[model samples]
Target: MQDVADQARTSKTTAHYVLTGQDQKLRIAEETRRRVLRAATELRYRPNLMAKGLRTQVTRSIAFISDTVATEAYAGNLVYGAIAAAAEHGYLLFVCETGGDPELEASLIGDLASRHVDAYVYASLFTREVQIPAELHFERTVLLNCLAADNSSPAVIPDERQAGRDAACALLDRGHRRAIWLVGEPGEQVLAGAQRTEGIRQALSDAGTELAGTVDCKWWPEPAYEQFGAFLDDGGDPSAVICLNDRVALGVYQALKARGRSIPTDVSVVSFDDSDLAAWLQPPLSSIALPHRQMAAEAIRLLMTDGALAEHPVHVAMPVRLRESIGPPRS
Candidate 1:
């Protein structure tokens, strides 16, 4: 500070005001402000944010706490989106992972609190019901890709039900009705699966039709392949299949192929989670995107709001990525 003031030929108070962005409020001359900034640059002066935070109680930093989001390659989008939003507001982010260990999570929370972090973003890779940590209950915190079990915290998640409705409507519009079957079971642990299934049912009901039947299988490639293969061997011939996710779609595709069936020609297939695999499939799969990045951005937006965020979860709309997999149903 003294070096900059001396180099700029200005008083230390003037240098302080300029560096802290208080010169404008004080009506300092533009020329003097320019000189202080130039001197700062030449001297390579860096302010001690921690010292300043001690006096102002504003650290201008946020903490992102999660179970496995930081470790997953694709799920890293959540951290990236939060970092971008925080940078736009001139704040830095601290990403911490607990690996689903409660003790580690508590320790991380305590350390962040000691550092005077301004806010928190609690995140999960999979959409499901979560219990908000008691440590974050009163803090400015936002939940990402998960709902609060107590419904007491602000949350951001993809609109699974709406995405399901859109997925079904896409097939129904192509003239598929009675012979359309769902390819995955809605497991109890995953909230997204059940919500999406409900949305599909609602859309089918609105069309004055219903599902022919559901081929129960775990939401994975291997399970999907085995069960769908079994279904085919049992004389199941469907016009279209709605896979719960892209992984399941892959299995369904392979099963259909083994039985000498062609996509859209013999059976149209649509799915959720427009993951990279969706595009790489033989005849690119049509799917509803998860909107991970958008959900993270919305979570940060709500966290940074001046006023309190609404307790109700914020729903980011899912987008339909259309491709060659869907077509008019054949007899």
Candidate 2:
């Protein structure tokens, strides 16, 4: 530890924290943290986490990478769960954000690996194909709240497909036949839109119903409002609408209000991701409640046990959350 500290040009305290797992800087200045990290890198000093953890057999550091931490509806709860789980096992957490960039994910993982992070956890905003770099393989790494093509490995994701179907079914139960779907833009790699939309379609098929129209709305309100507004202006008629997520739902509400339409009477609305704002919406919005905290805790648990998950994967489905948004179609 002393050698590493000298080589890294960092204080002995900082070096010890870097090696012995004792840095809890809830209020440390960012520049001071950066300086310590830079010195440690310049020294080309590698902390032997294996040796330090040989007897204890656990270094207690889990690195988490997220596609978009800021946009998540339940990000705070997810972090709380992860932190609580880690604390239970005397472990710590280091977080990184990829901002939905796959290439950057590989790079960030590589950097964390150099620190000899004990394990890894990757969280994606939506399900998609992940290009895991061979150089970034770890003894324990779990995908949280998402999945990849390589489903052989352990992953923790919400049963979004079921959630979508249930959302549709809820609307159907309220006497809605014709429905509009405001879907998210299907990117080249993101699979959430396609899978979720298929689930909604399946529900409609089972009920001998179909969508009145479809509108592709990305993760913004203005675009969703514009796209949906055009469809409404074009005389498109639907008694109910299902939004991709809470974001899209907000836009749908605005568009309807702009056109002098009332919700649950002129046009019932249902959305996924029952975010904090969902309940705050006018009359509240009916949505699917994602198991964000539960999923996060489960992922940390799996990652901490040296990747020794059972042969079968664990998939937990969150329940549907009905609010005041849906009602019978216009009489």
Candidate 3:
């Protein structure tokens, strides 16, 4: 700054204002501003960011701590969304994947805190209950796609129950009364699966309709194929099917095709997750979206808000993407 001021024959304050783009506030003449900039360019002058950060008490950076998001294909959108939102707010994101290791996570948090990051976002690939690290206490942090058991921090997750309700109602709206729900194995307690089932049941009950039955496929395409094929052989009849996810729906489609059943014309289908396969199917599959982007954006917004640590967890709504698969029941 001193070198630039001497070269331009101006006061240090005037040179500082010109170089920082604050010269408009000082009402400096345009010719003087040009001189300061020319001198700065000639001297290759650059502001020391670390010194500036220390003086301002802000680093303008955030830490994004995640579990498997860096490797998993389906949940990668969460990280992308967070990065884009952080850039929009003039902040940088430092992403670190813990691979579900508790000790590594603790160490990473400690290191980031030492670097003076403004805040932290702990994200999970899948929505589930999480135990926040003790190291995060008293820090500005937000949880994405997961919940803290003690509600220690504000969390943003998809509305699984509403997604389920939307899926069921999509089938019901097509005048289909008889339907079956193909689900994962019975004993596992996944919050998304349970909430979806509840949504389906509620919608059925409200419409004075009954679910024909539920088939547990262990959440695998092979089991789904075998189970659904046998059910068809046993003369099971349903006008619609609610698949727990897109992979199970794929198996259901295979079984129906082998029996010469046409989608929507014979049995309408609606599913969850809205994975890429949904749109790639012969006739595109209509399913509920997971809202990964929305949840991530909301997580960043929550972190930026005042008193965000005291606010309750927010559940974002999952939207339905309509495609070619659904229609009115057969006559």
Candidate 4:
């Protein structure tokens, strides 16, 4: 207390230590220590980490950043899991949301680096090609649930490849030979979409079957609707339709209904990501739910293990969830 320090003619911090004694391992006395702790809590006192870092030359805080997908519940789960895991390692997490702007993300990263974040977790939305800013680099960094191959940063991605394969195989096993992939915009920079498509294609090849057709939604509802209508008008009659992700599938479903086609009767539909709305679709959507929490936790684990980021990136893919949306091909 200020009064105690004034009376002792010493600094408040020094006065407390003088009273408590250096290297004293004894538990706090019921009377004084508790009162001091209570007062500190009431005052919302926080230890000055910068001052401490100056003394010790190490600050135990880490920065976790996502590229503007914080609003999406699925991506939010990854951030939550990463924060939880980071806490377990006695490190602080400073989170920054970049609103999907590459420039903003780069700026935030540079700012965090200047503050000397012990490490960094760069979370990106699923895209074809993500270009991490060349100005951003760190000794300890991990990409969470997305890919940034251009930067050569170690990344942790949900088993998208497996999810793609599983979705296709499920339909194939149910006696569907002709299938179409309702994909998102095929941007050269969208690694996740491309990887998932490759997985589906590979699975189909393994099963001695091939894709019936491919549809690019261009990531818009109206455009996807138009595309689907045109495809249907052109006799795009596949026994099954596989959507790249839940949103694209929703667009496809709408297009099918517009054409007076019912799911799994006139045409079977299967998709990926098994979003929150998937099961609640007119007739539950069959999808592969990415293991967001698991992937996030693993990223933290690799980050904290011996304080060394793995030399070779570790990829872990969880299996897909099989639901009723996928059924046998229409007779």
Candidate 5:
């Protein structure tokens, strides 16, 4: 500190403010700020962040705690966004995964708390309602891709209902007024599934129509294949099929092919999750993409800002990636 002050011809107080990015707040002159910065650069003086953290009681670091979020391919985007945003805010980020183990999650949170982590972005691999753990320091934590059971903490999640509405509109806009079947039945326990189902119904109802039918099946490909293939065997004909997800869409595609039905030419298909498989299909699939990266970044930003938490949860917009799978209804 003394060396920097001497080089810049300024007092230790002025040098301190400038070095710590508080010069403007203290009304320090522009030229003096420049001199202090130049002196800092020349002296190769790096602030001891550990010591500073003790003095200011802020480490300028964040912890990203998750249950299998880092392991899932799409959910990993949350970690990437949090790390990138933390760096941009001049904060370090520590990532820890619990793999859905409760004991490990509690232990990791305890370890991070001891180090005085300034904030937390707690995430989940799937969008669902969850109870925030008692181990987490509530006020300093933000939930990602999940909602608090008590609705006590601020949260960020994708707008799945809007995504569903948009997905249905994709077919409707293409002049497909014929029968539209939903390929997967949403379970009551799954919040995302139920919300998407509501939106799908709303869109159709608003259009003076409704779903022609639905095939009850699990979200996985195999179950969807069996159920949809049976629907076909029973003489089910759909102008457009709205699959619950890309995985379900895969099974639907296989079943349709086995039955000698061509996509778009015979049946238009649309699904969710614009994952890699969506594009790789013979006719690239149109899908509603979950905004994982955006939601993660928003969670970090919300934690950093004061009085930003509102009663309403932040719903990040999902983007529709339209491809060749959806087209006008067959003649």
Candidate 6:
């Protein structure tokens, strides 16, 4: 600071004001500000952020605790969105994965709290109910793609019901009356499947139609393929199919083709998750987007806002991406 002040021929106070960007508030002259900046640049001076943080009692850092999102390929958008939003707010984000371990998560949270992070964000690769540790000590905390058991923290999750409704409506709008829903096995992690199923059923009922049936394929493409193939062998022919996810849709695609049926020509198809493969399919698949990035951004925004640390859960909407996979059923 003294070297910069001497080089710029300004008082130490003036140098401090200019370097800290408080000169504008202090009504310092613009020329003096420029001189201080120039001197600092020429001397390659860098502010000691650690010292500043210690003095101000603020680190301007956020700790992002996740359960498997860091390692998952398709769900990495959650982290990307969080990082982008945090950077825009001049906050650094430190990410740590827990792999769903309670002990590791508690340790990570304790360590970050000791570091004096400004906030904490707990993220999950999928939307589900999570049991937050009782001993966690962060004042400002948010959950991403998951909800706290007792609604103890603000949470952001995809609107799975809306996603399912949108998928079903897409097929209905394309003139398909009857449809089958291929879903994953029943479980807490896969709760989205049940919510989606309800949404699809509601949409179908509103349209004066009904779901032909639901097939449990365990969320695997191979199982979906085999099961759907058997459905075809049994002479099942629905005008449309609402797959629980894109992977199941892939199996449906293979089954339909194997049975000499063409997409949108014989049957229209709609699914969820709008994964990368949706567009790369032979005839691009129309599906509901997961809204991972939007959910993540909302989580950060909620954390940054006053009173957003309350136990209010936010449900982000999932959008539908239309493509060649959906069309009017065979005339």
Worst 10 residues of 4 by lDDT: 19-28
Q: For residues 62-112, could you state the per-residue lDDT of candidate 3 as single tens digits?
A: 899999997788888898889988988888999999999999999999999
Give me the runs in candidate 5 sitting further than 4 Å from their true place. Answer: 1-46
- Minimum summed lDDT over a 10-residue window in model 6 is located at 179-188
Write down the TM-score of every candidate.
0.94, 0.75, 0.89, 0.82, 0.87, 0.90
> Model 4, range 215-265, lDDT digits (tens) per residue?
776754577677877888888876788777777777788888998998877
Could you give candidate 1's per-residue lDDT for residues 42-94 as a string of tens digits?
99999998888888878999999999999997687888988898898898999
In candidate 5, which residue pairs get closer than 3 Å at backbone N, Cα or C atoms, i.e. clash?
A: none
Candidate with the larger lDDT of 5 and 6: 5
Best by TM-score: 1
Best-to-worst order by lDDT is 1, 5, 3, 6, 2, 4
Backbone steric clashes in candidate 3, count: 0
| Local distance difference test, candidate 1 | 0.91
Clashing pairs in 1: none
What does each candidate score in C-alpha RMSD? Answer: 1.8, 9.8, 2.6, 3.7, 3.5, 2.5
Question: Residue 190 of model 1: what lDDT?
Answer: 71
What candidate 6 gets wrong by more than 4 Å, as runs, is 2-14, 22-35, 135-137, 179-183, 186-189, 308-310
lDDT by residue (tens digit), candidate 6, 190-220 = 7788788878778888999888776667787
* Cα distance off (Å), candidate 6, residue 10: 6.0
Q: Model 2 Cα displacement at 27 (Å)?
A: 44
Candidate 5: tens digits of C-alpha lDDT, residues 1-331: 8899999999999999999888988899999999999999999989988787778879999999999977777677889999988998999999999988899988999988878888888898888888788977354888999998888888899998998899889988998776999988687787777788888888888888898988989888899999999999999999899998999999999999999999989999998878888998979999999888788889888988886566668999999999999888887
Better lDDT candidate (3, 5): 5
User: Model 3: residues >4 Å from true position, as ranges?
Assistant: 1-14, 21-32, 41-45, 185-188
lDDT head-to-head 1 vs 4, winner: 1
Model 5 deviation from the true structure expressed as Cα RMSD, one decimal place: 3.5
